[model samples]
Target: MQVSSLNEVKIYSLSCGKSLPEWLSDRKKRALQKKDVDVRRRIELIQDFEMPTVCTTIKVSKDGQYILATGTYKPRVRCYDTYQLSLKFERCLDSEVVTFEILSDDYSKIVFLHNDRYIEFHSQSGFYYKTRIPKFGRDFSYHYPSCDLYFVGASSEVYRLNLEQGRYLNPLQTDAAENNVCDINSVHGLFATGTIEGRVECWDPRTRNRVGLLDCALNSVTADSEINSLPTISALKFNGALTMAVGTTTGQGKIFTSLEPEHDLNDVCLYPNSGMLLTANETPKMGIYYIPFSKPVLSSSLNQSLPPAFL
Candidate 1:
């Protein structure tokens, strides 16, 4: 979708013509309103969030009222109002967005990490501030209690950017050769990173010390395979509790609960409330699995019947 640059934030308003109401009868007005509602419902059912090019990352706000996503070919961030089932606004960016985080429930504040090591901050009005990291970042997590942004990349050290102080603090050191993704536990404030060596390291942000380590490759290996053959981590997420979900480049995902292997796994997301797991891969459809302690069950693919508009 075409969007204005940071300097050209636009305001959209709706106004009524003086004779518009008188021109339509009450029955016709009701029919038009009903048609509008039906169209909106169809769009919501299809979940038609689109981008001109490939979508890099997507996130839902804390309140579950908005969705923030980034797309390429002239990078842009689009915010959608889920409650209204419409695009709220979109802003063009200079660099491709690697990953992004929503900093507020209302989505007034957002942070975008670019591929060129640049970190940008945007407010509700427009571009707010920006900075750069020393290395190309893969993923980042925000620790709400300390207001610290932890960024991980293809290096052992995790860069800490203090949003409150607006400066870089000492980096968190790791023994792993490279870090691919990071997340913070909302329930207990534990910082976790998924390394390229197929290990998940847990840390305590308060003490800046490594508390635990999980060798995912070892746990996932079959009797015939070796640990060194597993691929690097491609996705990682925390369930706000003890469980952490890890996905590998080869489409293998391991969590407190396990899932059958697929192909070219892209990302994994968990819905604790519904005891469900959603996985996106290199295919046109997504996978939904029922999360069970014993062998998890593959529910279905997201290839459902669509309205004619989608066709």
Candidate 2:
């Protein structure tokens, strides 16, 4: 997906308008103030994988070489090389997997969520360790790579997991809700967590603290008034360069930017623009959230007005 001019967010000629669902047409039309946002998809695949199991969650790694897919059907975590789009490794877990990730820059190690009850960290060959979190968890993220600490967004509160001690530590509590944590996405210094509610939260990894929060209620706020209600965030990704793509379970998406400094690498031919943040929903039933968007999150004064995925 080609990002438009400097700091501008033009939905790359992605899927056509007919791709959006019928229910979203009126609500989407009224929300996006502009006329149809022209999108031309260079590549398109409607139904991706064939499985008796449905997708639990999808993720890309820090090094950007692999796509980690985890799900039910006596669920297992499978790793796939990004460019080759071929299966790299598949570990058959005794239980259904809810979330999975490749934590190393070399993609040497794996971390995963099992039944949202157990946390497992394994070597490439699946010879590794497992931790049964005391509380139930929906999703998890590893921060401060050198350390064994992981941010666990449980159904109620967020707990810090230390692999060194193999238990919970420094548990900073949230409101009284256990089934809140929906998805967790992290970059190097920062991370974001989504909930079953309309809230998307940001955090500081160093201090294990909350930074800020955004209410994505579809009807809360619009250009003039609130547009849509709280959107159910399905996926969250930190696509390096300090930007995140927030995918909702509903047929929609959003880009969250990082307020950080940029480097002037005059030595290279690379045109430094804002980071790339792209996401998608089931509207088109793509079953993949790896769509590309090179535009930076904060680089835009450009209000996003794009065509629906399936019209």
Candidate 3:
């Protein structure tokens, strides 16, 4: 409950009205409630505000202007203004929104992927267009420089979807496994995918050829199921043109540049305008790594060799 100065960090805590301790004295509870009331008076309070349904996913626009959130039961995306903290817009979806992304360069356009379909919409306006994928895609990444193109990973192929054209360009075949997550290195014009086979594949944008691979450590089996020997990648992200991070179902993680060994990383991301990488796992812990555009010195051990890109 201790926090540093505002110059160092700012923190906010929300209450769901769920009491943790079943035996707090009435006087102690009243004192805590009074403290919260005093703190609320100093803040802009939006009392009794509620969404139509439980929110499933929430995200902020890249520019930090708008907040986008989706509901668990309702097929919709709602936009809120950060300055006013007021709901600005809400668009209906054909199905439950699986995930969404606001284009890094064009914050006005948002691409939403659902369980069976995907749609592109203007953040201020309504729906712009919608399309069906050849196969249901679970995750996607946008091409940076072009800003109008993105790649969707399906079961065994990667499909390039150009929002400008409103159709898929071509499918890049991969090892016969489902692609878990894909990330683009726009500076290098390359994209990487973490596959069900527990390997990371780096691709050539123009030719759609496999240019490199990062294999996960499966040297020892720990479970009774043989599937444990094959790590399924749960997350993949490129820090920049030269650095990548991969997290596997086996709770293992690796940094592509040095092929360093890490563990319990379920997801990884690079800060938009900072020399930092973020990772988290089901352990519910997060780690931050600093990178000055070179191979970072991780505390983890280095063992396996990676494809040409790692070296």
Candidate closest to the true structure, highest lDDT: 1
Q: Which is better, 1 or 3, measured by lDDT?
A: 1
Misplaced by over 4 Å in model 3 are: 1-32, 35-53, 104-107, 146-154, 217-229, 253-311
Ranking by TM-score: 1, 3, 2
Candidate 2, residue 21: Cα displacement in angstroms equals: 32
Count clashing pairs, candidate 3.
0
Query: How much lDDT does candidate 3 score?
Result: 0.56
* Residue 142 Cα positional deviation in candidate 3, in Å, after optimal superposition: 1.6
Residues 1-311 of candidate 3: C-alpha lDDT, one tens digit per residue: 21122323222222113232338787776777677754333322222123454454555567665656665445666666756756676677768776677774334777777777555455445677666777777777877554435445567888776655555677788884678778787578787888777777888877768898776535323444345356677766565556665666665433334212134433343444443443432221223344453233331222322221000
Question: What are the lDDT scores of the predictions, listed in order?
Answer: 0.67, 0.49, 0.56
Per-residue lDDT over 28-60 for candidate 2, one digit per residue giving the tens place of the 0 to 100 score: 745552544532223333223223444455556
lDDT of 1 at 194: 87
Query: What TM-score goes with each of the models?
Result: 0.70, 0.56, 0.65
Better of 1 and 2 by lDDT: 1
lDDT of 3 at 187: 77
Off by over 4 Å in 1: 1-48, 225-228, 253-311
What value does the lDDT take at residue 103 in candidate 1? 84
